[model samples]
Target: MTNATQAQLSRTAEFIAGAKATVPLIIGAIPFGIIFGTLAEPSGLSTAGALAMSLFVFAGSSQFIALGLLSAGAALPVIIATTFVVNLRHMLYAANLVPKVRHLPQKWRALMAFGLTDETFAAVSNRYLLQENIQNAHWFYLGSFLAMYGNWVLCTALGVGLGELFPDMTEWGLDFAMSVTFIGMVIPHLKSKPMWGAVIVAGAMAIATVTMPHKLGLIVAAVCGIAVGLSLQLLLKAQAASEAQSR
Candidate 1:
């Protein structure tokens, strides 16, 4: 094969590998997407609105929160602010990835940013962390993003259809799968004191602020977790520097 053809084949292989790596996450999110669809109409959204939200917003937690707010007759600004806060975690994800992706063109960066869901972040971050010399790694990121985005949209459509036939589908408690998936994602990454501090503080804060309105407690918990984690990380780095100087 010509060099160009070989390069194309390599990109395709990387893309497929990215998608394959995300299969477990996609499975976990399937029920969550369906649950969002089932709850959307009952939460006062039209079918088109629900699908459009999935296609456009593409943030499961934010979508669910938006549905709750809509059902409760929240103001437009409230819905926007709440969902925006819930998505602030994406900033952290982007920060973690900026170093790796900074060299890409703006259009590529923008597309990747749009596709950066939690699942994609986890899969891609793990890939970057574990593999130091990957070729066309962005292809792998694109593959994971496409797999997750397509799966979410498809599952949302399925849920919308199933919602009509089974109006009580939300009562099935399928969202628990997503919780398990998140826990699985987090547990494996708790390899340092900073990570442990973040998790512990975040969990405590979440429980403590569970009664906050509009799910603002989630934002509070996330902020607290990040604060503790960063503080610990900085302190550790300083100590390490001091120890090296002493030696």
Candidate 2:
């Protein structure tokens, strides 16, 4: 085969490998996606609406917040703002990834941005950040992204269909199980002082604002946590620089 054809084949293989690697993580999210789907229609969204949200919006936390706000008859602007705030973390995720993906075409970056969930970030970090000498890393990211996107869409459709039969599935408290599972998945990644600080601050703020109206408290907590983490990181860096200068 020609060199170009061989390169193409290699990229395809890498993409498949990335998708396969993400299977476990995507499987973990099946329960969450189904629960979100089941809750969607009851939250005053149509089946089509739920599917569309999964397709376009695709952010689990923001989707839940939007559904809750919609159910509570929140104003459109408030719903938009709340969901935007909930998804603001993606900005940081993108910042960390930009240098790695800067060479890709705009189309690839755009689609990848849409797919950068916590799961994909974790998966890609292992590939690009934790390892050396990666080739066509974007293809791997694409594969993981497609796997997650497909899993969510298919699971949602199943949940909505089942929900039509069992209207009370929403009250079965399935979301709690998903929450526990999610926490387990995230705890292993808090391997640094900065991460621990962020988690503590965010958790505390979330608890303190649990009773806030329109779930605005989540936005407040997210901002507070980011602020605290950023400040702590800067302070530590300054201290290290001062010590180096003194030495």
Candidate 3:
């Protein structure tokens, strides 16, 4: 086959592979979404409001935490600030996506940014980094994003309905699922020295900030992790280059 034909075939395969890889993430989002909707009602968020946040913000942990703060009568400014801090992990997300989606249009970048939740970002970033070529990344991302989006909206409605049937999620232990899911997603990625450094630093920082009010500690953890990871990666790269030159 011609080079052009082979390239087209490869791109097609990537799109399919990306879509298939997203199924597990979509399945995971289902329970998380239901929990968010159920808790949101008690937090004084209307059903419509909970659904809207799921559709718009689409951040699982951040949205749930924001609802908690709001229910506690946090000031509007404080709520906004805390939400921003909790979601600042998206900056690390964006950095990871730079190489994959850099060639896409500006408008596409904005959409991807909007859709960049923890689960989606994790899947796409992992694939992009490992494959090292993201020619069809937009299609790949869209498949995962729409799958997640559908499950979230549907599950949120289910949770809102079930909230009437079952009142206390704390007893059900649904809230802790997010933490477990995050750890599961992260552990496999810390195979290298740089990645391990990032994980350890982030974990330590998160523990240190556990006493911080309104979930600000998550922001600190993510920032520390990203900074340490990137710095270590750069240092390692430099060392390898120097060794090559010496030889």
Candidate 4:
């Protein structure tokens, strides 16, 4: 094969690998997406609006919170602010991946940024951590992003259809699958003291603030967890530096 053809094949293979890596997370998110769809109309969102949120916003937790607020007759500003706070965790995700993608062009960076969901981030970060096939890694990121984005949209549409047939479908509590999936993703990564510290602090904060309005507890937990993680990391680095200097 020619060089160009071989390069094309390599990109395709990387993309497929990325998508395959995200399959477990996608399975977990399916019921969550469906639940969002089932609850959307009952929570005062039109079918089009529901689909638009999945298409455009593409943030499951924020969408669910926004739906609840809409049903409660919340103001537009309130919905926007609440969801914005809930999604601030994405900033950290972006920060973690910025070093790896900084050399890419603006267009590529923008597209990747738009498609950066939790599942995609987890899959991409793990791939980057392994430092495997660095040249075509972006293709892998794209594959994971598209797989998750497509799956979410399809599941949402399915939920919308199911909602029409069974108006009470949201009451079945199928959303727990997502919680299990998140736990599975996070547990494997807690291989260090900083990670364990962050999880512990975040869990405590989440429980303590569970009764807060508009699900603000989630934001609080995320902030606390990030702070704890960063502090521990810095401290460890400083200790290592001091030890090296003494030696």
Per TM-score, the best of the predicted structures is: 4
Model 4: pairs clashing at backbone N, Cα or C within 3 Å: none
Tens digits of per-residue lDDT for model 2, 1-247: 9999998998998799889878878878887888888888889999999999999989888899899899999998999988887777778778889988888889988999999997888778778887675668888999999998999888888889888888888778777756765676668768877778988998999999999965667767877887888888898899999999999
Model 1, position 77: C-alpha lDDT score: 100
> Which model, 2 or 3, shows the larger TM-score?
3
Residue-wise lDDT of candidate 3 within 1-247, one digit each (tens)? 9999997777677667666766776666677888887888789999999989888877777787788888999888987788887777788778868867878899988888888877777767767777755677677787667777778888898999988888875468665666766777788787899999999999999999999976778888888988899899999999999999999
* Number of clashing residue pairs, candidate 2: 0
Alpha-carbon error at 188 in model 4, in Å? 1.3
> What is residue 87's positional error in candidate 3, in angstroms?
1.1
RMSD of 4: 1.9
Q: Please identify which of the two predictions, 1 or 3, would achieve the higher TM-score against the true structure.
A: 1
Give per-residue lDDT, candidate 1, residue 112: 93
RMSD of each predicted structure: 2.0, 2.8, 3.0, 1.9
**Model 3 TM:** 0.86
- Candidate with the larger lDDT of 1 and 2: 1
| Better candidate number, 1 or 4, judged by lDDT | 4
Superposed model 2: Cα runs more than 4 Å off? 212-216, 223-247
Cα lDDT listed for each candidate: 0.91, 0.85, 0.80, 0.92
